[model samples]
Target: MAKYANGHLPARDRFAHWRELLSGTHAPMTLSSERADDFLARQHVVALGEVTVWPAVFPPVTFRRTRELIRRSDPESYHLTLMLRGSGIADWRHRTLRTSPGTFHTSDSSRPVEIRSWAERGRIMMIGVEVPKAVLPLPRRLADRAVGLPVPDDQGVGALLSHTLRRLVRDLPEYRLADGPRLGEVVAGLTATVLGQVTDGESALPPHVHRETTALRVRAFVEQHLGDPDLSPALIAAAHHISTSYLHRVFRAEDVTVGTLIRQRRLRRARAELADPRWDGVPIQTIAARWCFTGAQFSRSFRTAYDMTPGEYRGLRGGDGPGV
Candidate 1:
């Protein structure tokens, strides 16, 4: 989620700003607060393709998910929120939970709930994960057990999950647009691991399934960081805590090397950008720099792959370019 600087809104527009931002980020609902006139909030959003990790700070407010809201809207995915600062009291699924920093909780958009939040000193801070129910690798009944339940950050699976989410947010600078979907897979897998444990140990994914799932996570991480320029077999392996040899071996099974895929993806992105009218004002050198390519190298590689200079290709508007 990108940051919505509500503090910048005018007094007359503060309510509208906050209202739109909250509803857009989470589920559709109503917001109320005596201090709406002075509400201050912002968020950093990490969209991992299917999973979305959102960290936000807000002033005191009441967010309600009413029966009418539920009835009128299509069901959204489940959300897991870990409070980093401030606190909240939630009424959901016939239970009330006092949420504080170092505590996490789950909620279903399909259900009716009320959350009254209070600031710690002067602000409320939290991290939220949105996971589609269909992607979770668990039975529906077992997954339902987690909704509305508070899991402490230092205990059980919550500890690992909370830690992972924080790390992901902190490392946002290292991620790219392609990484969103891969990270989404990682979030879903971690969530499934936690939810699976909550129901019963035996209910967790089988060992083989777990390995396959983890492999997908590793691949996603690599793809997400592919544009780093420093991205290499060793770097990719180190980031995921795996051996370089293992990385090579695994990618071999896919019939392509990591380096080859990175080069191809970079070229594809560059080609797509060059062909699009939106990048028409962007200079060829500027575009090359972004993808870690120099003027000569980018020209040579692109011509070999697509048979045209970057500028010539751009001029063609993606049709009937130079062939000789």
Candidate 2:
């Protein structure tokens, strides 16, 4: 199993560790006496780290000093974070951020800002990307404000981006260096899209790329919720905070219907079970029910999608399997 260290490390040491990683240099952070270690975990994905922390342990401790730390970190090189696990208040310029579950705050390293996590232990997950400023494509002022601010979780680009980030952190191995630049683009695009900052007259996006991103997200969502029989078009749409019509549009653009996609996915899973000899004795009806095919209708639907009945497929495998 992957090892993880959970606890605090002194702030100066933590700062120096991150600085060395980001700068690719040997300079160490200067600290008189600062302690800030909440929890740190080695990310499952390469080129990234997963950290959960509360504001009380943040570097510099004081708001003014924390601002200086941000400046030293070089936001252009690392994307700092504000994620909340518990209810808390964040004080950012002109904005009093109420950090609730699902709150996400990102800031550029160069900017100076004060953020306070609410009284309750507010938790955050930070994934820093080593990217240059030239590629960010946003004005400094806008970027500063946009960072450390809440982006609505209610769908459109934001939900997709949030889902992608969560999945990336959860399934990091699937990404590669070749994917880094493109991932950065998606990150910037979604950030801009959610912030309503995408300018007019920009070149049209490639339909294939657009379709691929959404399709990947749809597939990921399906895979993640396989056990939920109610994961239908309406539910999927709701999950993404998109209207059913818009969800259908996404499917239609990919040359499929929402219902068709779901059934195909269910049948494909059912077929694998029916074919696997290990499940031979686990009654065919039970196997069907396990995949959400609870009745004759589902059984018929499965047969129509795949040529063999579930029982026939299981029977052909022999009775060696006793349970799922």
Candidate lDDT (C-alpha), each = 0.75, 0.51
| TM-score of candidate 1 relative to the true fold | 0.64
| Best lDDT among the predictions, by candidate number | 1
TM-score of each: 0.64, 0.54
The residue pairs that clash in candidate 2, if any, are 8-37, 9-37, 75-109, 75-110, 88-118, 89-118, 281-321
Candidate whose TM-score is highest: 1
**Error in Å for residue 308 of model 2:** 8.0
Candidate 1 regions exceeding 4 Å error are 201-209, 212-324
lDDT tens digits, residues 1-324, model 1?
476676677876777787886676777799998777777778776778777788888778888988898888744778888888888889985788888887777888888899999875887888888887887766667778877766677754556677678888898888888887867776777787777766673256655435544455555565567568797778877876778887777766567787877777788878887877777777877777678888888999899988878878877765433321
lDDT at position 3, candidate 1? 63
lDDT of 2 by residue, 1-324 (tens): 122323355533564443333233211223221234432322222332222111222222223225556545543532433242434444555566665545455544465444443323333334333334454444444555565567555455556666656665665456675665566566655544444332321223344444555665677688767768788988887876668887777887778897777777877787787787676667766776777877586668866876766665566756445432
Model 2 misplaced regions, further than 4 Å: 1-15, 22-92, 98-100, 116-125, 128-145, 152-159, 174-185, 197-260, 268-282, 286-324
Worst 10 residues of 1 by lDDT: 315-324
Q: Give all candidate RMSDs, comma-separated.
A: 10.0, 7.3
